[model samples]
Target: MKIAVMGAGALGGYFGGRLAAAGQEVTLIARGAHLAAIRERGLKILSPRGNLHVPAIPATDDPATVGPVDVIMFMVKNYDVESGARAIAPMLGPETMVVTCQNGVSAHERLGAIIGAGRVVPGVARIPADVPEPGVINHSAMWDTLVFGEADGQVTARVEGFRDAIVAAGATAVLPGNILHDLWRKFVSQATLASMTALTRLDLGPLRTNPDSRALFTAAMEETERVGRVAVPDLPGELVRKEWEILETLPDTMHASMLDDLNAGKRLEVDYLSGDVVRLGRKHGVPTPIHEVFLAALRPFKDGDPAGLAKDAVQEFRTRT
Candidate 1:
């Protein structure tokens, strides 16, 4: 079970570090100060489930330095998808399973172009986390897990072997029944939260508790679901309705990774999540006024605004995490 985790940030750092600690052979591709810290002090995982220090994790700046691998866990943000794909070419063997644990639905398609669809697997990451600072990942929730499967739903040797390897790493992993649907459902959830949170400058807590904000959140979800159904017409409407109920239970303080990225002034995945929703809505002639408005309001903060959101005004529309 030789695993290569490309993009060793929050999600990659947590999963890859845990796998390496549990004795799975994991190679992480990272760079800059975060990479230096991992190499110097090992990976510091500040997780509620438990803390771990992966003292001997293997990492490098270039995939060529590591050579071909068995499982390639793709964790790059949408902004880097294309370049990340090109970078991974040297590490991929013919049979390697490149699992994408990124947001939205198009990551597999983009990676497939780079590494061929036969070798691509789409993965969904369920984790509430962020990199509070370089080399330190603040995982507020402990339920981080990874689910991925073959594009054709065929339990090939590669898929099965990655499951076994992830389990051996003391981590929760599964090959889902309908991987595409899983990917979309995650999109519906994330787009709603990310757009709502970033647009309102409100975290999950405030967004869910206030009736006005909560209804607005539902509107955003409906917009995402409408566009998704148009793009993937076979998706069930009832499933999305029921899924909305499931989302209600999420802690109000919870925020999407995109919101955290926006707060940090880093390049965002806007083009994929909220931006993609708007794009598909236009492509399929679905009206997405709510999400469009959200995108319009938040796009400004991504580049020039460097202050932590204004507190008094934000508190009027925000709730504490």
Candidate 2:
């Protein structure tokens, strides 16, 4: 299979590297220092399952250079979806499938509007991975899975073919009966973890072990589930429980990608995660107090802490104590 990873960051790099190592034709769409590192050396995967290095993998900033592929893993950050969609036009053939692996549920609609809905496949990436440095992907947990399907839940040949390819690459993939429910379920899980970890600057260890913090995390999950149900009414009533079960299985060091961005002083995905929950809650007349607080607290840091106000406040409080 010919595959192109549009973002080719942590998530994309890890999976795309796996596919490439397994003899699939994979091209990385990346830029900046990361692209430079890939071109200079190769893409490296630091994973518990196994370490992989795909030397001489085709990588470029321009999609036109790679031409069309069987599948395009659209893994850009939530904020860059529109521009990313516009940029991938040159790589879209008649039968190419664009799989969106973003954190929120809105990418399907946004990408559909730009590139035609028929070609879009909504997907949820369940993995704890990040790029601690250029050309390096740190898979924080042993769990790595991709759940995706057609918008209407049909078991098309292309979907199954991609699933087989992913399994062949040693990663799990699922074709859910209803992709919308899976998308919302992932949203509930991601939004809660992202907001809490970024707000507290802690990992799953402290958040899950501390009773008060764990309760607060549960409350945030409930808030997100409420809003999610409003969007997808047929969502399971035990969605919160399901998410909690998944959380318990994660390693102690697991944290959201948003927390990584926050620590790196890069732009955060606040508008898409917690901010989206608040916006949808208002539109559907649902109360989302927890997410509202998260939205307000993190909004200032959305574009990053350029003024260093957050750092100054922390230092001042430490000195006072």
Candidate 3:
């Protein structure tokens, strides 16, 4: 299958490199040092499952250069959904499937608005992976799964083919009957984890081990689930507990991508993750104090502190006092 991986960061590089190694025609869209590194040394995937180094792979920054493709693996940060969707117009063939493996729920709708619902496939990526540096993808977790399906819940030939392609590349793939529920299930845990870890500046071990922090985590998850149930009416009441159980099974060192962004002083996806929960809660008349606090506290750092302007401001204020 011909695939175009839009945004060749951790998720895109790892999965796209695998597909390319499997002999599928893949073009990775990336920019700056990452793109330069891939073009020079190829994309590298480091994982416990196996390490893969595709010494030579097609990569470019412009989607139009790739032309049309059978599928587009959209893995940009949540905030880049609309711009990413619009940027990939040249890659959208009539039957091209654009699947988003992102952190939030609204990406599919946002992509569908630009590229049409038929071309947008709702997907969830279950992998703890990141680009520790340009051209190198670090898959820290043993689990690598991609779940997706049509918006209307039909098991179409296109989705099945894409699933098979992903599985053939040695990654787990599923075409669930209801992708929205799966998305919300992921969001429940993701929002809580991202907000808690980013705000506290701690990993999952300390966050889950401490009694006070654990209670805060549970409360945040419950509030997100409450808002989710209203947004997705069929979402089960037991989803909160189910998410908590899943969280327990993860490695203690695991942390959300938002925390990674925060630590690296990069822009965060909080507006789309925790901030989404707050927005939906307001729409449905659900109270989300936990999420509200998370958003408010993290808002200043959403776009990062490149020059330490925030730090400088704090220092100046301290001197004034």
Alpha-carbon deviation at 159 in model 3, angstroms: 0.6
Name the lDDT value of residue 48 in candidate 3: 92
Tens digits of lDDT, candidate 1, 1-321? 788999989989888988888888898888998888878877878888888888778988899988888888999888788999999988888778899988888889988987788888999988777777667777777587789998877787778888887777776788888788788887887887877776666678887788998888777787788888878877766655776776766786777766666655666677778888888899899988877777777776655344655334445554753
- lDDT per residue for candidate 3 within 231-305, as digits (tens), equals 999986688789888889988888898876776678989999989999999999999998999999999899896
Q: What value of lDDT does candidate 2 attain over all alpha carbons?
A: 0.90
Give the winner by TM-score: 1 or 2: 2
Candidate 2 residue lDDT tens string, 1-321: 999999999999989999999999999999999999999999999999898888899999999888888999999998899999999999999999999998888888889999999999999998878888999998866788999999988999999999999999998899999999998887887898999999998889899999999998899888889888888888877888998998998878888888877766789999999999999999999999999999899998999886876666656866998
Cα lDDT of candidate 1 equals 0.80
Error of 2 at 13 (Å): 0.5
Ranking of candidates on lDDT, top first? 2, 3, 1
Off by over 4 Å in 1: 301-321
Q: List the residue pairs that clash in candidate 3.
A: none
